[model samples]
Target: MKEYHVTVRRSAPEGGEGYLQEYTVPFPDDEIVSVLNVLEYIYRELDPTLAFFDHAACRQAACGKCMVKVDGAVKLACKEPAHETMLLEPYSTRVVRDLLCES
Candidate 1:
């Protein structure tokens, strides 16, 4: 497995200013994986303090729960493949907590 960096922004659960936190991920294969999976991976293996309530498998890009700013571009977390060095931030709205913004 290869290591990857996943950086999530810091914020509050309700709303607040955001910052960044980086995590290391191990990708066993080059195959693409959703950002939600990456987040889960980080939560499980890296940090648990990071807060987020994600509902993946809706597969519907409309839900917006998986919405996040990746490298400064707004994209659905479940829709984008986890990059090697990903920088995650809240979506353009209220801040929820590192990587999770108000939808």
Candidate 2:
């Protein structure tokens, strides 16, 4: 099972509760992948206790809700395959959660 580390910067559910958390996940194959899928896997199997929420739709690289920074450059999470170690962070527009930048 191939795996990678993802650092997510998510906002706290309440006041002054924002921080970065590292998540280790496994990728089966080099199939079409989305940032939200990775996040969902982590939230479902890896750690279900982490408090992070995201909004994603039309995994066809159209909707910008899944836009994030992978190792620095901003790209659509839904467009990029989750196939490597990535530093996922919020965009420059808004701070909703890890790797979720508003535009």
**TM-scores, one per candidate:** 0.80, 0.72
- For candidate 1, write residues 1-103 as lDDT tens digits: 8777887778745555456677888877865777777888888877888776577557557776777877889888778877888888777666545666565
**Which has the greatest lDDT?**
1
RMSD (CA, Å), candidate 1 to true, equals 2.7
Error of 1 at 69 (Å): 0.4
Give the per-residue lDDT of model 2 (tens digit) for 14-51: 73767778888877765555666787788889877644
Backbone clashes counted, model 2: 2
